[model samples]
Target: MSNLTARLRASLVAALPPEQLLPDSQPEYVRSYVYVFGATTLASFGFLIISGIVLALFGPGWWHVSRIGHFFNSIHFWSVQAFFFFMVLHLWAQFFMAAWRGGRGITWLTGAVTFVVSLGAAFTGYLSQQNFDSQWIAVQGKDAMNAIGIGAYFNLLNFGQMYTYHVFLLPVAVAALTTVHLLQVRRRGVVPPIPPRGLGG
Candidate 1:
């Protein structure tokens, strides 16, 4: 296992050119406020993970009954809300800029898929909160799941079940999808703006 790990690490270092990993210089055109959105998304993701760890450490049981737990839970909840909100803005801006064109279509498509999955994960997280709001959303959301024949596989009323998915299943899926999305983005590099027509050499 150690040998395999070392070989994999070496392969990654070789595959990723140092210039691509950290360039001694970058294009001047890349300098703009719009470019900051990607970094902001990364920052928000960090916040989500840290807050999630804190919530987990407190334990779901503690989170509901204790003041510190409740406060941290609120922070986690709002952090998720903020994460999705910023993600939407970033996705929309990227779309309008036609940043998906050229060879970047795969990166854009992966990101779009991630966004959709993230929404479901976020919804499930809320429903699993096991609060009054959770109860209301669970009842409301079950209809659609039932209508679509998915409720049989997922029980909204089971707090234990919902909590398992919220902390484990949904997060694993989100993280896996996010990993793929980030890899695609890194491989493709950031897309440049479309050139004006008739400027072709």
Candidate 2:
């Protein structure tokens, strides 16, 4: 076991050298405003997570009735809006740049998957609101879930289940996927600039 653990540690260090994982400086190409969107998305997501934890700790009534809870709820809500806004900007920038090029395909795929999973998290969040708005959304959304034929397992009307997903499952998935995507980026580095016209890519 000691030998195995040493080998594992050695392998991990080799795969993720300190310089590669946390470089002192980034490449000149990475200074563009377009690249800034990715970091902005992460900032918004951090706020979403902190506010979400507070809101979850206090339960639905606290968020609905208490002033502090309302403050946290508002924080969570605005954070969600900012998160999606910046995430979309980042995604679109990556798409336009064809960020999958030059061996970054898996990085691109992980980011795309994270975005899709985040959408589910956002939907379930609305269902977990436990308000009249949540009621109407749940009623309307359940049919869509049913039409897809996973209603038995993913019933949108079940507040408990939806809350579990919004507060736990989907968020975990998004965080994990985003972490993996960032790791891949740290390992593989950022995509290079496109070549000028008539200069082969």
Candidate 3:
């Protein structure tokens, strides 16, 4: 364990350098509205995770019955909504910037996959709510899932299973995927935009 930790630490130090990792200096060209959107989107995801944890710990049904639980539930719901909102904006920005152009194609693709998985996670979460909306979505979504044969493995009508998935399984998968995606981003570095053709003087 100690050796692994030392090796990991060494690798990070080699890749990032002390100054860049804890940044006393930044590139002048890094200034742009585009940069802010990435940070904002990340912050929204952080909010969602924190709020979701609170809801999970309190128990989803507890919120409907208890005052504090209800408040946390509200926060969780708002956080989810905020997360989706920022994610959409972030994706649009990346698309407009043509961010997939360089070796950063992996980063772009990984992010796209993560976004798709996040949408699934979000949908399953809503279905697990066990409310009127939950019932409606379950009955509606089951047809699509059944048609695709995923319903065999994932039963939307089983509240117990759906709840477990939303609280534990789905989040774990998202966390794993996000970890890999972030590692790819850090390794590849951010992609620079393509220069115009025939611009040389």
Query: Which has the greatest lDDT?
Result: 2
Error of 3 at 120 (Å): 1.5
**Where does candidate 3 stray beyond 4 Å?**
1-24
Candidate lDDT (C-alpha), each: 0.78, 0.91, 0.78
TM per prediction: 0.86, 0.95, 0.86
Candidate 2 residue-wise lDDT at 142: 83
User: Model 3 over residues 1-201: C-alpha lDDT tens digits?
Assistant: 369988999998887675554555445655678756666767777877887888888777887788988787788788788877877887898898787776778878888888888888888889877689999999999999999999999898998888888878877777788777766656656556568788656
Question: Which candidate model has the greater TM-score, 1 or 3?
Answer: 1
lDDT string, candidate 1, 24-97, tens digits: 66566787776777667667767777878888876767887888888878778777877877788888789888
State which candidate has the highest TM-score. Answer: 2
Q: Which tens-of-lDDT digit does each residue in 16-132 have in candidate 2?
A: 789999988887877779888999999999999999989978886798789999999999999999999999999999999999989999999999999999999999999988899
RMSD to the true structure for each prediction, in A, is: 3.1, 1.6, 2.9
Relative to the true structure, candidate 3 reaches a TM of 0.86
Which scores greater on lDDT, model 2 or model 3? 2
Clashes of 1: 0
Better of 1 and 2 by TM-score: 2
How many pairs collide in each candidate, listed in order? Answer: 0, 0, 0
